[model samples]
Target: MKVHVHVSLKPGVLDPQGRAIHHALEGLGFIGVNDVRAGRLIELDVADDTSDAALDDMCRKLLANMVIENYRIEKVAA
Candidate 1:
């Protein structure tokens, strides 16, 4: 089984790195560069028996910070 986890900051949280990247893009003459938000993608291959409940536990325990970020889990069979 393969799983993809996306972790991102909730709205209203300042993203300095994203802001800097956006500025750099603008300086490079890229137009219509609207807002930018940074995030992370985690890919994992687990045993076929891994359950949704277990994946959720993984996210809550190690993949995401509930206080500042949100996470989504997607599972696929190998």
Candidate 2:
């Protein structure tokens, strides 16, 4: 089975990388851009029998920071 983890900063959290990217886009003459929020995608290939509980635990314990970050787990179609 294939799993994808999408991790991102929660609202009101400071994102320096996102700010930098927004600035860069403005510098490049891009317009109508209000804001930018950067995130990460982690792909995992696990056994087909892997349980949802285990995957959620993986995100809560290691993949995402419980305080300022949020994560979503996506099970990909094979």
Off by over 4 Å in 1: none
Candidate 2 residue lDDT tens string, 19-59: 99999999999999999999999999999999999999999
- The backbone clash count of each candidate, in order, is 0, 0
Candidate 1 clashing pairs, residues 3+ apart or interchain: none
Q: Per-residue lDDT of 1-78 in model 1, one digit per residue for the tens?
A: 899999999899899988999999999999998899999999999988888999999999999999889999987556
TM-score of each: 0.92, 0.97
Give candidate 1's error at residue 34 in angstroms: 1.2
Per-residue error (Å), model 1, residue 14? 0.7
The window of 10 residues in a row where model 1 has the poorest summed lDDT is 69-78
C-alpha RMSD between model 1 and the true structure: 1.1
